[model samples]
Target chain A: MDDETRALIDALVADARESPADLARQTGLSAEEVEARLADLEESGVLRGYSAVVDWDRTDETGVEAVLEVNVELDRETAYDDVARRIAESPLVDTMRLVSGDYDFEVYVRAGSMGAVSRFVSEEVAPLPAVTSTVTHFAMETYKERGVLFDDGDDDDRLSVTP
Target chain B: MSDETGSEAADRSDGTAPPDPADSVEGSDQSDPAEASDPTGEGETTAGDRFTAADRVARVPPSGIRAFFEVAEAHDDVVSLGVGEPDFSAPWPARSAAVASLERGRTSYTANRGTAELRRAIAGRVERYGHAYDPDEEVLVTTGASEAVDLAFRAFVDPGDTVALPTPTYVSYEPGVTFAGGDPLAVPTYHEDDWALTPEALAEAGADEAEMLVLCYPNNPTGATMSADELDAVAAFCVDNDLLVVSDEIYAALTYDGDHESVATRPGMRERTVVINGFSKAYAMTGLRLGYALAPPGAIEAMTTVHQYGMLSAPTTAQHAAVAAIERCDDEVARMRREYDRRRRYLTARLRELGLAVAEPSGAFYAFPRVTDVAPDGDDEAFATDLLDEVGVAAVPGSAFGSGGAGHLRLSYATGMGELKEATRRLERYLDGR
Candidate 1:
């Protein structure tokens, strides 16, 4: 690869969230070169993660961010796709992740306000057939923002990739 | 974590609280924890892609200005200082000229290069800045400065061309470049230098093979102006590199310090610069949708031909009105500029009082103040949004203009002095609330 392609990959690693064309231009690389390197990196597990850079002010102002930990009551006949689709349609839910441990699913929601969060749970999530119970946790502060860490920071606090 | 067995997932068992659907998907996965279960049961086939559906309909999230407007939309009782649209009507002479054109039944399309009279007026106007153009060949009237901006990019840039921009500049520049299939290379201008784009930064951005240089002054978000000496240096650089300059001087007449400098005036520059200006800011005619571009004859021909195929012509009556605006609205322009100057002074003082790091804006109707002085870790987009939610006043985030906009908010003084004062009062209350 050329120097420009290397610089492009370095920038992409710095943020880990840039579009291929954007990374290419910033690093003075051709878009094709950037795309090829990105594909190689993805195949090798060098670029393993991508996440949103939340504008906390806009998010907090428009809605409240809540991590809803849900414990599902297991059943054979229950329609899981129908339930997931219902949650996905609601404007309040920003991201929904399936996690390990006691909770079956971790859902991140952003409501218009604290009141809106309660209303959304009561009106939308409550009506779903297969759901059992949920526990909500509000984020207090983001101590270290995503895509802003490098070698100087501790590996534990920073995001790392396994090759 | 409760280890609930299957068959307990039929309905809401916990009667006290509402059961969220997210739990049901989780419950199904847990029923067979060892075997991977697809929530959709199609094993990876969804009815429609969740990601694609969400991405297709995604909205440009509510900025501080938009959020405030939404609130004002619901509550008419709320005295809104929201949205930076100028409160003044198009000056009387321009309005009457438009009315006269309607009476005379001048509603049909004019030439794609615009009504000859208006094109002549634009040429005459540019001549004052020492940038002369051939009205018949080098000027093409667009729907507005917005269209001219897009046309300039479309005319000069091919796919993958890099267009250098100075930040905190116009919000529309980057998007316009993108629409024309060009990448925006935003060169950050420091607040300490009054947001001037220096020769060094310009040279660095231009070092690569690029098709266009997008310049706006007196700038939008920062309200910064480049002096004649600065303009000369930029013009020389463009000439040396054989790069086209897309100059957006919509706020040219609104300069407070002195006459606005046009880079097109420099030697061997007019042939390479497309000068974009409009009747919007100068005559308080934002709704009129009238603007024109003066480029080298060949580029103007291409742009005018594009207009012929795409737009046909600008509004007929607005073109007539624009002719009158250029001919007779000198006094009205001066008056509005004076009012804006007063508001600029008042806002600069208020920003300083609020402990914002700000320099006096020399041109345009905006004051870009650094909000980090009060909230060190404050995000421009976040702080501005929260400020609107808490207080009624609205301002755009600095980053909307370009990369150098972090930790800053752009306050437009285009409203009345009383409204500007009220906005400052609301900002103070918002600071205290935080």
Candidate 2:
């Protein structure tokens, strides 16, 4: 990406909800210029989409979060993409990525409870024809997410002095 | 104004020269003459009378910039664009480092020069600008770039010497020179030329007779920076005139259009130049009071001598934090610069849209817009005062800077986007009424 586009993406990454006028002000471009560039970015697929970074723990809908490592038997004809696509079809799968290590895919899964995750792994994941082994690591707490620190209290300790 | 023999005799007995009567008169004249005459006056004794301040101290006017801030502070809901400080807190790593230092009880004073680690970090950072200095011998940590500028004046300026400073610049340079017992010669740069300090202006400002020249790029108030070719010309002039150059690069990191060129990095200029920089603008560490000066060993030695006698060393905890800033906060600094650049562009464009003439500021977070078209009497201070009173939008009068600043107003974009937008809206309404 060009420097200007990269800068725009960086700003969006920092705060997705920033208005085009705000972005224009920050980037030294007019609102129209910012709108045009953003349209081009969206059309070119450089910008996938914008979404809210919800703190799930703050809401009633939070579920058990776990990272699942799956070793899958690769098909000589279809390869890993087919298996990855099948696993991604499950609503419990939050994110999935093919891997290069012992595990063929690493997936993030969320469910109502630990029991539900265990049931899904045993009843659905383990029975897959391509699945070889599976390991699950449950997340305890999130210290940071999407660049925002969660627990650090806002206290400025620097001495207050005139410049 | 007393040169009474009783005082002079007392001074002479101590083998000190008699105080100049003319200087005493000039010193006492700034205050109420009645108070100076009456020792038993109810009012508090002024510092000038209590201590023997140099005559120049009395001549130095209180910073006009501070007066506007005081007026802004008196009102509620004022969207102040007068302050020169950044609104963002210091980056997390730098602040966390200070907390860690405090938790570890590392609070004692550091070496007279500074902590070795911080000096090393400063040396490494400045090297990117193509200047080199040995951390041990050539770097001295200071209490912000303010102290560095003061130390430079104290070390180099002698009585009756002249210090030539470009006009519409930061307010501190002139006073620093005056306090050091040197004459401050104003070099005028025109807004027509984007306030660029031309070689012709330098010569006209009496650079030949001046013992030192103070150059602040990405300047305060004006927000002007010299190009590489411009700097080369200024460097050549300094070389030909054998003038010591004290270049304040505090705003060096804030330049938007191009890389900042330090005069010290110029060929044949390093030996005679002292570079002043700090963590304030770049890392948002203004409250930490951490800055440093990079100069040749001889000049550093002289500044260190004055520093040791006065400041001893910069705050130890702040020094530790500064090391963290220099070593780890490069990304944070860049992030803040981008934000400032955005604000600079917005503010400049908005001011121009309001029918004022504004030069696109290449650096710093301020826009100096000519206010004569809207000002009632073509007085910048009056214009700024009226704006604050009418619309609660506070800006600094350019006259507070120096010569060639009378027709402009300096508006800072260090505030948030919301406040800046509100301030511009209010300013537009106020100007429309005028």
How accurate locally, in lDDT, is each candidate? 0.67, 0.78
Per-residue lDDT tens digits of candidate 1, residues A1-163? 6545455555554456655644554444556877887788779986776666665663435556788876666477665565677687877887887778987678888876778887777677766667788788877655454544223432221001000
Give the least accurate 10-residue stretch of model 1 chain B, judged by summed lDDT.
B1-10
Clashing residue pairs in candidate 2 are A26-B342
User: Interface-residue RMSD per candidate?
Assistant: 22.8, 13.0
Report the lDDT of model 2 for residue A120: 81
Give the CA lDDT, 0 to 100, for residue B123 in model 1. Answer: 86
| Model 1: colliding residue pairs | A63-A111, A74-B6
Superposed by TM-score, candidate 2 places the C-alpha of residue A162 at a distance from the truth, in angstroms, of 7.5
DockQ of each: 0.01, 0.14
Q: Write the per-residue lDDT of candidate 2 for residues A5-34, one digit (tens) a residue.
A: 666776688778878876776676677988
Question: How far out, in Å, is residue B116 in model 2?
Answer: 2.8
Q: Write the per-residue lDDT of candidate 2 for residues B1-434, one digit (tens) a residue.
A: 00011122122122221222111211222233432432222344555555443456656654464345456667887877876667788889999999999999999999999999988888999988888899999999987787788899999999899999888887667767877888989999889888888889988877887899998888887888888998898889888899999989888889999899898888789999989998888887766777789999999999999999988998899999999999899999988888787678778877877899988799877899999888978899899889989999888888877877999998878777667889999999997887
TM-score of chain B of each: 0.83, 0.89
